[model samples]
Target: MLTPTPTIEKPSNLVAFAFLLIAFLTGIASSFQLPTLSLFLTQEIQVSPAMVGYFYAINAIIGIGLSQILAKYSDKMIDRRKVILYCCVLAIGGCLVFAFNRNYYWLILLGTTLLGLGSSANPQSFALAREYADNTGKESVMFSTIMRTQISLAWIVGPPLSFSIALNWGFDWMYSIAGLAFLFCGLIAVTLLPKVPRKKMEQNTPLQAPSNNQKSVIYLFITVFMIFNCNGMYLINMPLYIIHELHLPAELAGTLMGTAAGLEIPIMLLGGYLTQYFSKKALIFTALWAGFLFYLGLLFFQNTWQLVLLQFFNAIFIGIIATLGMLYFQDLMPRQAGAATTLFSNAAKLSWLVAGPIAGWLAQFWHYNTVFYVSFLMIAIAMVCLMKVRTVN
Candidate 1:
């Protein structure tokens, strides 16, 4: 049941589209928090900058643990829809807490725990989509790639809309609406998604010895972790830099994020098209260069138009790695798609576990723009690590 092989007849087209909608809704719901949480911490909750970073670090830590544990047991369950439904419900509750509460203790103990568990929805949705393709005997890799685009699609509008609502009405209104997205997402999962029957449980195989490429894969994971930590720090620091340091209006931050997300879809498609002509290492190096350029722009170009233009580089820098990194792990562990994808997801969260506190301290001690400087240095480290691994396809 845990394997990628088909276990049942193909699901209906309606079921397929339902998975697509779930992916988008889950993303939009999650996206509302991604760009706005730091702002909420500073403006609504009145926390210190370091606490904002620590908040994310703690949340990511819990989220990684919960997502992995849930993913571990999902295939063992009779119906994974139950797991998705439970995660969605937890997300809704977390949003409500944000809507009404300001106590940091309650927010940390209860709020982060709920949202942390809620992080499981994303991987579970992809897992279901992968299962959708596998059981139907459709092409799974392309299917999973397309499924990921639903998230990019969501972010194109989600951040701008979330910030707009927060700016005009208040944080509470923004969060209440976000809760509704999760409500609809959960309803769709329990009502619209399929409950495919599972194969009889197979005996667990003993874990094999480390493969020859395990060392290289370990290096790749380390490099990817470092790279994403920069992104995690950027996400926490960027809005504050724009609003407090630059004295720019709050809405511009959302638009900047929206601009990058708008370009990510097309760039991902184009990169996928070009893979036959370029080695994955070559493209990854190109992305790292684009990342360096992006952070450099953030350092020097503080104006609105120039910053907006920089998102073109941002899209290329982030879009390729997000998709390819997962594929890279899948290639390294072909038999364990479940484990591979979960590891990819955990790498993202695990990065944040470290990134948040560092970003907070940097902003507190030096200046907000210093976070960009450190972000620039992170790309150099990533590029160096990339060179140590042998070339990948």
Candidate 2:
């Protein structure tokens, strides 16, 4: 009996590089909308706070439920590129709706749903990277490196561009620009991505089964959930805390938040390199502990400058946590790339969905400071759990 010769895979550097560029652009466009969209809804559309919260919650709920379905469907489909192309189109349409519509509730709901679909690009991007890596015999660390680089690039470019556009041309132009960006990404997706052939089932293949110890993945998911809850709490409540609790002016609040975002870029860039020397588990635990300390410092923050300084540290810690956590999770499930990415993404969304309302209620009743304390406690707990995690390698 003759042994079957193994099929050799060819390298596609052009394909891999193009996918990374697209991912970077997609992230930049998405981040541009983050700082201003809520304000636009509340101030321009005259939507109530409660309604804004509800809209965000609904977006999270839909995204979390739909992500796995989309991932599984993409796995079954012959062409993953088509799924990505359609998602980009939906994002563009969502942007158009928000840009043009005067019906506040309808527009907000449609736009949020579109944002959810657009956000789907995140996992899909990782899936694409994983496919490329598997085909070319590249290490999984390269995928994490690409993701961190893209995220850092997006953070550096997005805020200033959005702020400038909003300042000169108004929020309408911002939405229009975001829509154009999405359309551009859609076009790139359709033009650049080749059809990837579906994999055939084989006996004793690495991709055939889940790894024996998946509980580590579960712990990583829990840690991601905790970190994201802290993130969501900060995003939802930070401005209010600065304005209402700290009595800072609106311009100052905006400036501080922008500065925090700017600080994240360097930290994230450093994270890509640091993960090489440091244990992923140690990096994550340290980030959580540092974030907890920053949150605790918020209690004693006296002046605007103190809060600003804390935010800088907060950004650094959060940046490290996000990058390392993602790398760790991706390594844990080298086979189920789409499912793993979807699971981690959904865990973050789940954190936000649960954290948002509770943070709002805590602010309403106790105080914003109380919310921070609760967040700090959660991070502390997460750090403990993360310390218990054993590295998969």
Q: Write the per-residue lDDT of candidate 1 for residues 126-240, one digit (tens) a residue.
A: 7666665666777665566666788999988888788899999998999899888888888888777776545553114222213765666676777788778878888778889
State candidate 2's TM-score: 0.85
Task: Provide TM-scores for the models.
Answer: 0.83, 0.85
Q: Best candidate per lDDT, number?
A: 1
| Model 1 C-alpha lDDT versus the unseen true structure | 0.77
In terms of TM-score, the best-performing candidate is 2
TM-score of 1: 0.83
- For residues 1-393, what per-residue lDDT tens digits would candidate 2 score against the true structure? 111222133236656666777777777777777767677778777888877777677777877777767766666555566777777888888777777786866765677777777767767777766665666576656455656567666766787788788778888788888877777767766665555444664112343124554767776788888888888888778778878878878676666666766677667666666767777787776677778778888888858778778877787677786666766766776655666677777887799787888788899898876778888778877876686666764
